[model samples]
Target: MSNNINRSLIGNILKSIRVEKNIPMKKIASALKVSESTVSQIETGKNSATKEKINEICHVCGCSFDYKTDRKKMIDLVLYIYTQYSNLSTDEMNSTIEEVKSNSFISCSYVRFEYYLILYMDGIINQNNEDVQLFKRILEIGKSSFSNKELSIYYDIKALEKMYLNDSIKA
Candidate 1:
């Protein structure tokens, strides 16, 4: 999980989604058979929601939570989504970024390695220090677990980073 999807952001996302569906927090609390203050605490990030509670919320939203078990397929899906999102408007791109960042499908080592590869490319494209650092950190964490394909991408990102730095120096 990325640092971007912290407790507060998760709470906010849940709250916003509930509001968008015209569901009140009090109603959700009643459905969960919990006090309104408990739900309020979860929404404000003051308390953590159990897995069962999250599932209940998903049920209320008329959506099923997919705990993707297939690592390879999940990676493929993320790549496909990335390809499709490339041409999205800025707002849509931001939304997609947030969604990807929030999703925990990268729990698998291979998927996490692939995610870091994508993050590295994003850093190269944007030339941002934090993204570059994050990519490096992820690369280090997953270095031993990397497949040959990931190694290729890691090296490519390194080359791209050098080029970006050179261009910056010249500018």
Candidate 2:
């Protein structure tokens, strides 16, 4: 992913965590010795936070921030959602959905498509038609550029969505 994308994702995750914990922007600014607007800019992705500043924000929010680890976790979560969604409890599913929605910066187009597929399956989002159109455009533009894994995910999403929308379809 690009640095700007990472910064935005990190900022979003920080903001989500802070909001979930009921920590105000002003409090975070006070703890970090920065202006509230600085905190707001960081959270809004208008400005990138330094590593030290990110650490301070996480510390104030009583959370840990590791960009690579979190990104990996998101990838794992997306895979789990795709392959084992039926096994997830309601609370687990809802929480995972919320986390994925908050940190919506999957760099891989296929993975991002799968994320959208899962959300559509859960009825949390209604982008099936748009997704289909986007996939068609991708296929037209760069069909041979996709990896085997990417194609596999695209097919899996199509099959799953098909079965989901039409219960008469058999395996």
lDDT of 1 by residue, 16-69 (tens): 446545788888898899998988877666777666776687578555444444
Superposed by TM-score, candidate 2 places the C-alpha of residue 28 at a distance from the truth, in angstroms, of 0.7
TM-score, prediction 2: 0.49
C-alpha lDDT (0 to 100) for residue 148 of candidate 1: 64
Q: Write the per-residue lDDT of candidate 2 for residues 58-111, one digit (tens) a residue.
A: 788776664443434444565566454556466676677767667544322224
Local accuracy by lDDT, each model = 0.57, 0.58
User: Root-mean-square deviation of each candidate, in angstroms?
Assistant: 11.7, 11.0
Error of 2 at 90 (Å): 12
Task: Kindly report which residue pairs in candidate 1 clash with one another.
Answer: none
How does model 2 fare in lDDT? 0.58
Clashes of 2: 0
Candidate 2 stretches with Cα past 4 Å from truth are 67-73, 86-171
